[model samples]
Target: MKAPSTHPIKPATSIPALLKTAFVNALIALVLFSLMIGIRTEAGSSGQLTYWTRFGDLASIVAAVFGGSIVIELLRQWIGPTGAEKLVPPAVQSGISFIGRYLAPALLIFTLLVPVMFYNQRYILDLAILVLTYVMLGWGLNVVVGLAGLLDLGYVAFYAVGAYSYGLLATNFGWSFWICLPLAGILAAFWGVLLGFPVLRLRGDYLAIVTLAFGEIIRLVIINWQDLTGGPNGVSGIPRPSFFGIPLDNSDDGLAARLGIEYSPTHRIVFLFYLILALALLTNWATIRLRRLPIGRAWEALREDEVACRALGINTTTTKLTAFATGAMFGGFAGAFFATRQGFISPESFTFQESALVLAIVVLGGMGSQLGVALAALAMIGGFELFRSLESYRMLVFGMAMVLIMIWRPRGLIGHRAPTVYLTKAQAISSDLVKEGHG
Candidate 1:
């Protein structure tokens, strides 16, 4: 006869416990929303503050939060921790994996066709350009924060450096955009190296703080240095990028005139769209290629465990510097493109917010995931415009969406860590198996 187990079976959570948790959560929501959502504040004509209450809206939000809390708790208890994977059937997981394999190539094809399909819609083209710009930025930062596992909060410094480099060279020396582009990238890489040297020994929170200070320092220097950087007013009259050496303007040498087509200003928009698309493609290609190389493998190892990387005799210093330089070079390219696109350069354009947004794309997409970053950029940027009609509630909705995504997919949209190198066949290493790096 078999002996029965002596261990007690775990008890399910009681209804009262669930309600208590919900009530506590609702109370916290009430306190937090009381001032921000419940009350509307404005400055009166006489310089005094005026206020109004929206207790109806406040009560509705609190009640919803309470209900949501209970539902979440119930779901959590049902799923348990290890049950998350089991929730999705094996067939569904196989389908998702199959879709992921083709998703990148399909996305690329769609992006290439965007300008052609939306040739007449100027707004769509412009929005596509904006999305592609962020896509490039996200890919560039992905090298550092994603693959290398380095937390960078001052990436905008490189962006500003690139923009200013192109602006000054073109404006002062009368150099063409093509001539200044490489120079801007080089200068930004140099700055990246400088940043790498100082923070060589720093990691985690310390690294983030130092990088943030570096970005603020660069911004402040641009603001205070009126002679060279033009101070806060920034530099204007920056030349636009040309198709080859020919301009996109209305002159006889303009692209439209040369092509014997009417100059409708849409030509310039389409050209800019293609230009950014090409740059973004180049960024994606280069990143993908580098991931298969030895240095790329080093970055992955470093990300997994710095101690293990050192024990394996990899030079962490060079790895970190190369990651920064490579990432910065791409950022510089995007920044130079931005300066030309806008026909102006300003410190205000490269703010901390830009860095945050790019970082968010990288994180939300999946760290070290090229396709994930691109998709995230599209969602965050294009989705923002989609909610324009929501007005004041747009940000709230956006935030709620992000929160829900985090709750469901904490590792990101595509959290799988595909092995850079594998025997027999390359398979994605589960995120749970990968260490997120020390730095």
Candidate 2:
């Protein structure tokens, strides 16, 4: 005979209790949102400060927050952290895979045709170029942060290295962009190795601090090395890229002239778009190929458990250096492209903010996810562009969105992680199965 369990089951949250909690949460949100959005300040006609209050804004925020709180409460009761398995079902995984196959080609084709589709709209084309640039940067950082599980807060140092390398080489030697691109990557990779050697024993916050200091050191050096780096004035008159050695200017030797067509500014813009697109594609392709190699597997193993990886006889030194070098190489390429595109180089462009944004893209996209990186870059950058009109509330909205995303998808937007090496048939793994950056 079996004995019945003596423990009592917990009772469900009462409706009144749920309502009370929601109301309290909404009240707190109302107070915070009111302070953020209810008041406005501007210069008056008499050159004095003026203040305005919007009751309507407060009411809207209260209602929205109240509604949001109620929904969150219900969701918490239904499927909290303990119910993670419900978040990623086998059916959902299959659907995602099905959509991915078609979505990738469709996206590539759309991106390829964007300049042509909006040929007359230079603004849109310019935005596309900016998006692709970030995508390349995100992919590059993913190698170190996502694959290698190295927290690099000074990635922009490598970016600056590449940009300055190209600028100095081109301005001093009159070298073309094509010649300086690879050289820039090499210089940046060398710096990456140099940085990697010293931080070989460090991890976590220590490693992050060292990388951050490295970035600041590079910036300060650039500022103080006025004779060589031009200090704050920066280097200008850097050459623009050419089409197979054909210049893009209005001269007779320009591509527009050589093609027997009247030179339109659109020609240069189109060429720049394709050039960045090609670079971004190359970055993505290389990352995908690398993930299947032995080194790549070693990176995943190291990311999951460094001690265990060393126990298995993996050389952590070479692995770490390779990750840094690979990431720096791509960053350098992007930096050189940026310099040539802008026809200028400056330390202001590579800042901690730039590193943060790249890191955000890697984290928000889901660490080690190539497709997620591209999608996240488009979302974050496009969101910024879209909300530019809401100048005052843009950051508040962006911050709120990020918080909500973290709450909803803590791991990342595309939270599922595909297996590095499957013995039998491969399948997407739930992010809940392991911490990020692990296999």
Off by over 4 Å in 1: 1-15, 33-90
In the range 348-413, model 1's lDDT, one tens digit per residue, is 987899889999999999898888898899999999989999999999999999998888788888
Which structure among the candidates has the greatest TM-score? 1
TM-score, per-candidate, Cα-based: 0.91, 0.86
* Whole-model lDDT, model 2: 0.87
Specify the poorest-scoring 10-residue window by lDDT in model 2. 1-10
lDDT of 2 by residue, 19-136 (tens): 8987898789777877677887789999999989987988888888878888887786655334334445557667889997788799999999999899999889999999999999
In model 1, the worst 10-residue window by lDDT is 1-10
Q: What is the C-alpha lDDT of each candidate?
A: 0.89, 0.87
Error of 2 at 125 (Å): 0.8
The TM-score obtained by model 2 is: 0.86
